[model samples]
Target: MSASTPFVKMNGAGNDFVVVNALERAFTPDAGQVRALADRQTGEGFDQLIAIEPSTTADAFMRVWNADGGAVETCGNALRCVGWMLLQASGSDKVVIDTLGGPTTARRAGPDRITVDMGPPRLDWREIPLAEEMDTRGIELQVGPIDAPVIYTPGAVSMGNPHVVFFTDRLDDAFVTGSGSLIEHHPLFPEGVNVGFAHVLAPDRIRLRVWERGAGLTKACGTGACAALVAASRRGLTGRRAVMVVDGGELDIDWDEASGHVFMTGPVEVERTGTLSL
Candidate 1:
């Protein structure tokens, strides 16, 4: 390691991550390097890594990496971290940042909390890119004992990523941890998927826990919230507007009945700032 890398550690609804700035120098960290950085004990520790680089669009170009060193198109929490950085950088309340998935706009709502418009949701089976095409809405997927009797149908939605949400009778704490990974990498999801176990508590509220693709388990996933709301709505379990409770915290989710798109509103919290040594 030549020098310690300056970085920001943040989390949105408990999806912890480290944001790295690549503008000054490049480390070209491999999977092992990324793992070291994401180590909960020894490394900087995070679920994912966000590298900010010089960009032709907006203020910067952001690259996303799972703790496993795989690339992902979008990350909602990192967007707010970027927004936080942008607010400090440009002295503005809002910023437009481009992602490989698409462009994202975020606004500083409170001290360190931010609200991000995660763009529109993609609901096509082809978009979710399931191995087989079927109705993404209220589709059948099986894993463990849940089967059709337990989870029945789930809504498949993509926010530049794939998600499968089970609107069950209750938020099974055990299943969320035990069965989540089984569903996330199911053969049905060719590119793999983020798995959510959701239980509708009321007309506009639900509880959730997620298993994220490539990153294994995390505190929360913003795109997972959007997908859960959409899935619940399709199953007639909840209204278009709902609040999803995640391990990290809470996220307000709304699926526009008219537009067929889902919107997720949440907060991003910057825990600390530090420099990574290689």
Candidate 2:
């Protein structure tokens, strides 16, 4: 490995990332390397590491690694951040990005803002890939006493990534961290899951926090917010479109009734540009 790699630090709704241009230099860091870069105390520090590589179909291919060095299938906030970068570089309003999940298109919504067509939310049991067959709208899962559970019958959805959302009136940090950690590795989800605690504030608004599968807690989680909206809507707790307020900021999520695709709109910030001594 060379020690002359360059990278850009960027964020979308405060979900920070370290982005590298693998298309130019062809650098692919392994799990250990990714962990070193993602460590907040000893490394460059980011919620995720993004590699922008060449793609045969789309404008570019995006590879994502969580802070724990686990590669994930998709990341909505990263997609928006990458879209903004590619748009700035190519001087185009739209770009198609290829991911392990599938292809998605992004367009400029405003100055420094992006709108990504995240596609449909997978609501089927086989799609979320639970360990057993069950209804995704409210799966057979609960925490606390059997008779009166603290969180029960939560919903599951996959926006190219699996997520389990629990609707509640409280947004306790301890509950989110502890319960999220448990459900993230629970047996019901064979592939593990991103656990989200959503507090519905109104029919068109929700407050959310997420413990990412391999990233732990984060300032913002784009797909988590999207999943929150879908789960809330399916349960009639909220409308199909709503504003998701995360710890870092807010995002507008809309699950189109006609198309079944979800659209996420948010802002991206460029923190700094620097080179990494790999």
TM-score each candidate: 0.90, 0.98
Measured on C-alpha atoms, candidate 2 has an lDDT of 0.93
lDDT tens per residue, model 1, 71-97? 888887677777778778889777788
Q: Clash pairs of candidate 2?
A: none
Query: Scored by CA lDDT, what does every candidate get?
Result: 0.79, 0.93
Candidate 1 error regions (>4 Å): 145-149, 169-174, 256-261
Best by lDDT: 2
Q: How close is candidate 2 to the true structure, as a TM-score?
A: 0.98
Model 1 Cα displacement at 193 (Å)? 0.6
Q: Each candidate's root-mean-square deviation in Å? A: 2.3, 0.9
